[model samples]
Target: MEIINFGKGYPANVLLPHTLMQKACESHLQEEKKLFLHYGHKQGEEKFRELLASFLQQNYKTAIEKEDLLITCGASQGLDLICQHFTKPGDTIFIEEPSYFLVFKIFTDRGLNLVPINTGKNGLDLAELESKLKAHNPVFFYTIPTFQNPGGTTLQEEQRQKLVALSEKHDFLIVADEVYHLLDYSMRSPFPFCHYSKRVLSLGSFSKILAPGLRLGWIHCCSTLLNKMLEDSVLGSGGGFNRFISGQVYSFIKLGFQQQHLKLLIGSYRLRSGALYYFLTTILPDVICSPPEGGYFLWVELPKGINAQQLLERAKKHGVTFHPGYKFSTQKKLNNFIRLSFSFYDCDILEEGIRRLAKCF
Candidate 1:
């Protein structure tokens, strides 16, 4: 039997826009081969940044300028750059109780102290966050405000405004990792945090929307912070971040392929998500999951007394797989929860995966 994979947060291979990417490469090579191939400005390619700024302005409905944007390799590198420039060893950083697990290593490698703030279906608990802020002068609060990883929760707009207010009051930075913002299927999300506060540094990537292989993303922030990040030796010494990839991606975005591709991608995920949710709900009635409005993952709460790790092992034996929730936690809480990604498979595969997972239970 084929292993039914609901474990990895990757786009389905079938959905990758191979033709659009080839066209982008051909167009760039034909028009600006020498310029794109040559060394670019340390800050980024001016044309790419300008085009990206316009793209973001039109889609996100926020005022953005070329000076306020800096291209990075992707969201991972963007987080690393933030840590390298803005934090010190042992500095306090606040993160969602269960966030993107991969990011934990990034923080720990920097020797930063991570404090977990509890989150629910509505997103982070503002009261708990405010209490934590009162006690620690954290360098930044890292969050995936929309369709949060692991939890698959969206932070409400009131909470967002309040969080921004608290950030200003406490003089802390907000590192909003918004890689999944554009993938919403039902409702349009609120304006990004950058629009509300200068203290916010919003991260965006083509990885989720277009393809991760491109390795292109951008940081939106006030000019002051952008200037400081640009001065980092990592960027300055390297000349720029992914200049060639950025130029080609800019061509793709310029031709409006991204918007067209996004509709198809979102529709595919919507079907997969619906199928998975229905199957899990029917097969494991006690399991609790809030169907996500947008993004790749669905967060499930296991029945009482069930351990997700053991479930994972059993499911693996059954030729199925998913992420155990404890991996996403800083304090190793939430052992009864699991994160499942519907982004990597079709409806039939999702159904089979859930069936195998049900057998494990």
Candidate 2:
């Protein structure tokens, strides 16, 4: 039997827009061959940045200046760039407890101190965050506010405003990883964090909505921050990262292909999410999980005395797989939790995976 895997947060291979991307590439070569083929600005091609700024402003209802955006390889690179420019080896960086597992390496590789704040159904605990902020004087607070990875929680607007206030009071930067914000299925998300605070550095990626191979993402911040980041030797040496790919993506957006693609992705994931949710809730009534309003994951908390790592080993025998929650925690305290992704499989495969998972429990 084929392994029904739910371990990685990735778009289904079938969902990738191969034809659309090909068309965009062809269009870029035909329309702007010279501009795309030649070395572009280290900050990004001016036209593409303008297009991106307009796209975000239109979609999120926030005014964005082209000068305030920096095109990075992807959100991962954006995070790395931020750490490189803004942090020292031993600086304190706060993050949500049970945060994105991969990013933990990014922080640790930089030799930065990782402080995790407890998260709940409503998102990060403000009291805990404020207390940590007051005591630590952290370099920055990193968050995946909307449809958070491994937690499936969206921070409320009120909490967002309050968090911004806290950032201002404590004078710490807010690094908002918002790649999942645009993938919402039903509930509307709040404006990007940059809108509420000038100190906020918002990171976005096309990996979820489009294809990950494109390797295109942007950093939204004040012009001051953008200028400082652009001064980094990496951008100066490379003359901007992913300029040609950025040009292709700009063509894709200019022709309105991204919006159409987003609708298809949202609709497909919504169905997959519902099917998995129903199966888990009905078959394993004792399992605690919330249906995510958007994004790719469902965070499940198993009953006490269950260790997710051991559970994964058993589930593997049944041809099912999922992400054990311990990987997502800085303190490694959530052994009873697991993260499930609905974006990697169709509804039929997802339901079967959950059915197999239920048996393991």
Candidate 3:
């Protein structure tokens, strides 16, 4: 099928380094041998945590310790674990209106009442956030701080500080999903929320920038809460984690190959994003697209009277498809918006996809 799928944030044009697999195989043969085939530990491997902690501290400026980090299958699972540990059924949580919808489903499935907070061009509006804090005294405020999903907007520096201040003032925790943190289009990558507050629980994953198949992610928090979370993970998932796979990843980082690979990937995506943005702006002038700071997506607001569903129907006929905007909103009112991912396809495919989308418009 000649398909142009701008629907998911999946990496399209990349492949996991064959070298990584070969290295993992070699490591398994040398390090674990028979033990490599066994079940993984629940808490994740120790070396992976240490490597991650050091990487985040050195590169991202987050003072994360090995004790403060817990590995998960990915950040998605980390979200589930956080919900399972912190909030109970009937507790209130604040979510960005146009959020990563999987979070909304997770909170709802766990029986938490969600209060949607509207985000502005720069990111979530602090005034609205404070109002919700006063109204609900929510258990936590969940946000995708950088290159936020669907909106592709990064939180401004002042706004980030305001969020931290609100969490402290109102005594609520912040669950930061920093999955897209490494995808920097910003002048400088924004600081993780934990830098400003101890109450913040930040989630990250290697899925976006690295191999999603790794299913490796981490949660970082302060001492007391992180201790409880680690305990919870042990009870919930059994032991530490997959020693074999984690060991391989740890080895990769120790050798500085992972960072080098990521830098190369980021450079490639930067070019793709620029080309995609230029194509869309030049072809679809009437559409309102966010100026992404650093992330894989462009949240385009179609012309006022255009029906996204109707456009999608026509676009599908031309072998191109994009996510409808309504899927990203809690209230399901953002019908004229759609999220386009430039991470997957080549420039030629992207050019064709934009052309098809333009025809729909």
Q: How do all models score by TM-score?
A: 0.97, 0.98, 0.94
Worst 10 residues of 1 by lDDT: 31-40
Give Cα distance to truth, residue 236, candidate 2, Å. 1.0
**Residue-level lDDT tens digits of model 1 in 1-361:** 8787777899889999999999988887888747577678987889889988888887788898899888999999999999999999999999998899999999999999999999977679999999887689999999999888878888878889999999888999999999988888776688877888899999999999899998889898998999889898867667898988887888898888888888888898888888889988988898999876889999999998899999989998999988898889998888989999999988878888888898877
lDDT, candidate 3, 82-177, per-residue tens:
998899999999988788867778889999998889985667888888876666979898999888887988887888888888888888899999
Cα displacement (angstroms), candidate 3, residue 361, comes to 1.2
lDDT of 2 by residue, 1-361 (tens): 9998898689999999999989988888899847577667988889999998888887778798898888989999999999999998999999999899999999999999999999977678999998876679898999999989989898889999999898888888999999998888875888888888899999999899898988889999998888889898977777888888888899999998988898899898888888889988998898999977899999999987889999999999999988898899999889899999999998888888888988887
After the best TM-score superposition of candidate 2, give how far the Cα of residue 121 lies from its true spot, in angstroms: 1.7
| RMSD versus native structure for model 2 | 1.1
Selected candidate, larger lDDT, 1 vs 3: 1
